[model samples]
Target: SNIDFNPVEDEDSSRILFEIKCHFNLVSEKNNDEYKLENRKLRFVYLSKLNDEVTDDKKLLDEIEKFYDNQGYPEDMNTFIEYMPQDSYTNCKILILRFHEFLNLEGEQLRLI
Candidate 1:
């Protein structure tokens, strides 16, 4: 995770960016079934901390919608965006994004996207 100031914003909006990548396998040795878990999906998650005042979920969704309206939605990647509720420990508003490549592409393609 890294914190950076947004130069385009007028106020002091410093955001923290966090990235997580992982892979999981569902194969089992004892339970032998016709269907096998041969493919393992790669998941990439990104979390961005928003301004402190954005405590409302509606406002957070609207903010992300505005961003998509201005910058346009991503084409190559299947993306899911949601607001992460404030945690008791950190109490920070965050935008979580999960991105996956389309057409059974390799995991590295997500990095390029």
Candidate 2:
């Protein structure tokens, strides 16, 4: 039987996975009502697409799935977009995610690989 457990092997991929996991943990731990007025708790976390040759949305989604599955998703993972100002007439679209403290089998904030 062929199992598609695509483990994060490449250094770049590994770094990305670690960064994302840390981001989730940070956001979850700092999730408070006062700071959540407009979901400002996750403003500094994101995944960049500007450097990747694989520009397809579907492929990116698959990569995210593989990373999450291999590394394990956080309890209350919430994903969103963070718009960063780059220059005039331009803004960087950063992918941000926050892990919640609910619906977790392991009852953890994050599991980084």
Candidate 3:
């Protein structure tokens, strides 16, 4: 009797799975508008990561192609990926603003003398 349980043993694959899970959690916590926008933004990151690998998984390959079709990017995905760093910076600023709000620090004076 053989069981068909395929656990991800490869370190890189496991790391990718963990990252995707984390990303999914972050996206799911947002409101509908935020979720849609973040989901599309993060899809670019995944596309860039997967583009570097030589994979034989037809399903994944097909999904990648479908993404290009749906997104209508140029032939080179890197051209679009170049914008991620700035996008990440903007997201960090938003997070910092939220953090300050959570701490009730908005419009407050910090005296460090």
CA-lDDT, candidates in order: 0.30, 0.34, 0.41
Clashes of 2: 1
> Which residue pairs show collisions in model 1?
none
- Kindly list the per-residue Cα lDDT of model 1 for residues 1-66, writing each as its tens digit: 545633222121111111111122224431423111111121121113332334466564565444
Candidate 1 shows a clash count of 0
lDDT of 3 by residue, 1-113 (tens): 64343322345434654465576665443345545444444544445444434244443444454554554543433222323333344443343343234223311322121
Candidate 3 TM-score over all chains jointly? 0.26
Window of ten residues with lowest summed lDDT in model 3: 104-113
Model 2 quality (TM-score): 0.28
User: Candidate 2: worst 10 consecutive residues by lDDT?
Assistant: 96-105
Give the TM-score (vs. native) of candidate 1.
0.27
The number of residue pairs in model 3 that clash at the backbone is 0
lDDT of 2 at 7: 32
